[model samples]
Target: TLQPDVFGLVEAARILCEDGFAVFPYTTDDLIVAERLLAAGCKVLMPWCAPIGSALGPINIMALRSMRGYFPGVPLIVDA
Candidate 1:
């Protein structure tokens, strides 16, 4: 599994791994990290929407497409 946020995600992944889960945290705000996650057999999970009450749409189509290219079977959910 992969998380967008860095702070809490690392801890969550670490704990999950300790609990025998095959967890991997993708924290770096870099596309290379996404590819690495895929190479390491992680499913990408990104929030392609604004936070809470915000109204913005998908701001990174290229990045999204790149992720899709790497993990087409991995589910993509828009938290709108």
Candidate 2:
């Protein structure tokens, strides 16, 4: 399935956050998107390590590592 618009996603997350919901957005392995989601009040980030259900584990180790480095205390669940 095609991904939703990033702007819309952030807006939705922001709204849900305002309503006191913890948002955990499933996202591509993109640091910029992760940053935006965090700013929009997402509690956790679920970044894809590979295409969904491909059984490829940790295809982008550097990206995952980068996320960890960028977000020291934030939880980053691999969404493979």
Candidate 3:
């Protein structure tokens, strides 16, 4: 679920939403990515709890918190 191509994901999500499908996107710790995903009708996001395959936990707490702030009520799944 480590989708590096944010714009591609956004376009896909937008299409899905238009077709009445709920979109759950996986985003890195990029706030801009989250914003665009939300705009594309993503009600929830799955962000990395740590780098993929690193086995670390919540590497950037500040970034996570910032993402939460940016989304407010949006649900974020911090994938590990």
Per-candidate TM vs. native?
0.50, 0.84, 0.85
What's model 3's lDDT at 56? 69
Question: Can you write out model 1's per-residue Cα lDDT over 1-80, one digit (the tens) per residue?
Answer: 33366545655655665576765453443456545544444455453444444566655667667766766786655455
Instruction: Compose the digit string of candidate 2's lDDT tens values, residues 1-80.
Output: 54446677778888998899998887887888888899888879988888766776779899899899989899988776
Task: Report the CA-based lDDT of candidate 2 relative to the real structure.
Answer: 0.83
List runs of model 1 lying over 4 Å from the truth. 1-4, 17-44
Q: How many clashes does each candidate structure show, in the order listed?
A: 0, 0, 0
| Better TM-score candidate (2, 3) | 3
After superposing candidate 3 on the true structure, give the runs of residues whose Cα lies further than 4 Å from its correct spot.
1-3
Clashing pairs in 3: none
Q: Whole-model lDDT for model 3 versus the true structure?
A: 0.83
- Which has the better TM-score: candidate 1, or candidate 2? 2
Model 1's alpha-carbon lDDT is 0.54
